[model samples]
Target: MDIQYVDTYELTRAGQEVHGQAPIDQFERLIEDLPEQADTMVSWTVKGEMDSFGQRFLRVHVKAAPMLECQRCMKPFEWPVDSHNRLEVVNSEAALNVDDAADADPDDAIIERILGSQRLDVLALVEDEIILSLPYVPKHDVCTLLSEPLEEEPDGDLARPSPFAVLGQLKKD
Candidate 1:
């Protein structure tokens, strides 16, 4: 299947919007992170606009629930991914680097910069967003390991005596 490509600059200049739904398998890089090939689909919408400063920008939104392995329990769980990004289209990479350096606080900077391209890979962009949205250590709020019933220990000699038992014996003596 052919991956989707868009002319980012033109899309922003024309104020166009495109939306699509694609199977998770289509994202090659994202597939590597998944535990299995889930029957999941990712839905995305890209809207282009010119900001108040006449700067071209693309607003990308993506939503998907992919099965990811939990780091703590080592079990597969559905990870909900919803990401929204505003990409400022820069004429050159130099401009992007300059802006990045000038932004003192990344937390305060809401808009991200990307080099404007005539044929920007849309799937790649979506895949990048999905990966960014994922947690560094994917884990459930409550790991399943804690809920699983532990095997019952055998009683009698197999069970080790408690440390305080010696103190109890001394007290009795």
Candidate 2:
């Protein structure tokens, strides 16, 4: 689908929906945030409608794998993202202020301040949701062995003892 920008008013008013699967390269911001190069695809489904509160909303579900640097190993790891997000379309500055007041933490729900245009950036929305779905610190459950251990080698070299071990030896003496 050619999801450059969508007409929000018409989409919400008519209660329309859009769905597609696209490569992760399509998401520029998401790619920039990753530490290593990624090769993955993101699938999304966006539905536009007015809720019972008479508020325009876009419900979205996105699935993808983002490449992230492991905190422990500093190696690139792929993290699968499958998340759902809801955004309330706020039409004006006044509407946005009211919505902002209603929820101090915008993360309570995403608010889209339409800033003089009915055009909604579908790519950004999908990107933001995927970013939010990711962990603050991405790491592998078990890292691969990438280097030699801290223990002394079998060639008769003495290993550096721990500070606590030296202190204990002093106490024994």
Candidate 3:
């Protein structure tokens, strides 16, 4: 089914938990965002919470495997994607725009200001996370073509110049 939006405020307020699996095919933008796709689906679980400061928070865990085209050999490969996110829901974007926003602690949960009646486009969020998880240049760890191609020799043996021949001439001189 199509997952467009969710009432994040209510879910967070009631401390609700949401978990489900959906086919990635529903996400058109997500389908084309990466180089390729393997027949797969995205599974996710979102849990609500309230911090000591009475701030609404949501923890999201997503898992998926997207087919990726190897940049080194142009071969299709599956890239397992598992992402976890913790978000704090704020009343306004002003909180997110504060000067210290950029300096927020990495270990701290990311702050997400409420948007449009506290409704969240969950699918969009998943798509974004998937995109961020993609490798800049997808490639296999060990590519088969790393070594140079073997050159064809004349027959069983091929003779050329010898280093000793030049040394022999020098010795004669």
Which candidate has the highest lDDT of all? 1
Which candidate comes out best when scored by TM-score? 1
**Per-candidate TM-score against the hidden true structure:** 0.77, 0.70, 0.72
* Per-candidate local distance difference test: 0.79, 0.71, 0.68
- Residues 1-173 of candidate 2 have per-residue lDDT tens digits of 56757778877888999876667887888878677656556777788879787778777888777788888888887776768777777778787656455655656644554432467777787888888888888777566655444555576445665434533432331
Predicted structure 3: lDDT: 0.68
Name model 3 segments beyond 4 Å from true: 1-3, 33-36, 101-106, 109-117, 147-173
For candidate 2, list the clashing residue pairs, or say none.
none
How close is each model in CA RMSD to the real structure?
Answer: 16.8, 15.2, 18.4
What value does the lDDT take at residue 4 in candidate 2? 59
lDDT of 3 at 172: 37
- Kindly indicate the candidate among 2 and 3 with the higher lDDT: 2
- Candidate structures ordered by lDDT, highest first: 1, 2, 3
What residue runs in model 2 are displaced by over 4 Å at the alpha carbon? 99-117, 144-173
